[model samples]
Target: MTDAPGSEGPEPSEPPTSRREGGGLRRAHSAADASASTTTGARSARAEFETHVAHARAEFEEANERIKQRTGRDLILAIVIGVAIGVVVVASLIFFKWIFLLFAIAATSLGVFEFVRALRASGRRVDLIPQLLGGVVLMLSGYFVDLWLHWVLTMVVVVVLIVWRLLGQMFSRDGRTYGAVLSDVLITGLVVLYVPFLGSLAMILLSQDGGEWWALAFIIITVAADTGAYVTGLTIGRHPMAPRISPKKTWEGFGGAFVAALIAGVLLALYMLGLPWWTGLIIGAVILGTATIGDLGESMVKRDLGIKDMSSWLPGHGGVLDRLDSILPSATAALALFYLLSPLAVS
Candidate 1:
């Protein structure tokens, strides 16, 4: 009021330091709040990213599963078709042994062709004519021609073909593929003889005194075993047994097959075809067990050849091998069973 100009201002408020310190406290609190917000935002962003990644992974898995399902359905379809044809053909040849024999020979020839194709797929160049002749010889060997003459023809054909092939290889200007030749021959032999050998026994069974019904029962048992395995595996399959070769097969499936086969055998004895369920039971157990070996054997061949199916002739079904793998071994067992039980032959 007295001296300095106008004594203006109003009280000067408080000291600048006191005001600044209050402002400083406010700034520090605000900065801390901002930092907390930043951290929370970062955590939320991370959680969102993780959720998106999980969604993507689940979608990928679902797509893969769908592909496998479609593949399995196609395969099952083919097998059913092929099996149906076979059942019809076999049923037709029920009485005429010669007609059945001819069918068996032709079927074996087709089988040999498929096997050679598999070998060739594995990079083996095989001579077709010699192998084809050998298969023909094997298929016809079961015919009841003049015993001595048939034997002579079989021995001569085998010797001449083998020698001729070997000489061709030894004198080849570009060298021969012994691996291919041997593999082709061996595969052809197995293919031609495998089913015919087993089927021929059924012929033998039917020809015996009043053994027609028993022969029919013999065929029925194999169908029963295969049906059991397929149905059971599709239902309660859990643990994968062989994913690389056969993804759908499970140990549980095998157990079911065994049980089904055993029951069918019993039924055969009791009612169906009048096989005497007790005898059917024994036959069932033997055939189912050995049939597993045949199934695995074909699997082994496919695995070695790096092939999925033996061929693509039948739609939905892979090849003749695919349909026959499990049943082929059963043929041998059935034949042996017949010899053991039938009146005509003794094993």
Candidate 2:
């Protein structure tokens, strides 16, 4: 249809294909706008998540720094090492009892080695070879022989160490004096009695029927007390329990240790050892006393030796002796308790 000049004919109706094209374009634009909106929302969500993650990371770092500043050691590293030791011990204990014997032997040997080195550092002479050999024999005796034999062998080792030290002094090129020989003999006796003798008690415990569980129970309780003391002292400790010995240790921390030991003892007695829950109290009390004394005793030794650690063999923990201090004495206590409480245990 033709329209006159300056006049429209029926408003010039649009073509059908053109109208469809225009409608399609409008739909496409709407879709594009919706997609853009969705993308923006997703980006916002992602940014928020990242922000939260950053905040959490920052908080963790701050906490870690605080722990480091207070403890003079990396908390995470200590936990990792502690966990690794625990895994090895647990695996050896659970898989085979004899494997734990090997573990004990190795631990005692290392402890003796470290002690010898520490003494040597102080210019004191120690017979490392005899001590190591004697330690192995003592551990073997504890495992293979009866209780009486174990005691006899322990005394024999001490005497052997003393005599060996005396003979070495007599035959030495350095021409030792009586005072030096006496000191060496005394130190030798201390080493044998301290490391191997107490360690043998654990072997003895493991030799008994169902002794592995008791050993594990005592170990768990000791670890619990240590962990509780550490955490509590770091968080809210004020008054020092033994400032001259361990400045970081606090009464509050000791209380925490007591509580944790009590709980651990109860649980282990009831579940692991199949004993009366009340027995856990006794076990906990005994272990706590021994563990505390052991820790303090070691600290005193280190203070006298003028060293912060026995050695840096185990990172964040000092050395093997440092780790074994509590366990070594607790072993004796645990064995005694086993004899005392065996009647109450479930068969």
Query: All candidates' TM-scores?
Result: 0.67, 0.89
Worst window of 10 by summed lDDT in candidate 1: 338-347
Taking the candidates one at a time, how many backbone clashes does each contain? 4, 0
Q: Estimate the overall C-alpha local distance difference test score of candidate 2.
A: 0.91
lDDT of 2 by residue, 224-314 (tens): 9999999898888999999999888899999999999999999998989889999999999999999999999999999989998898888
Which residues of candidate 2, in runs, are more than 4 Å off? 1-32
Tens-digit per-residue lDDT, 154-202, candidate 1 = 5565566556656665676565566766854554445434544544444
Work out how many backbone clashes candidate 1 has: 4
Best by TM-score: 2
Error of 1 at 237 (Å): 1.2
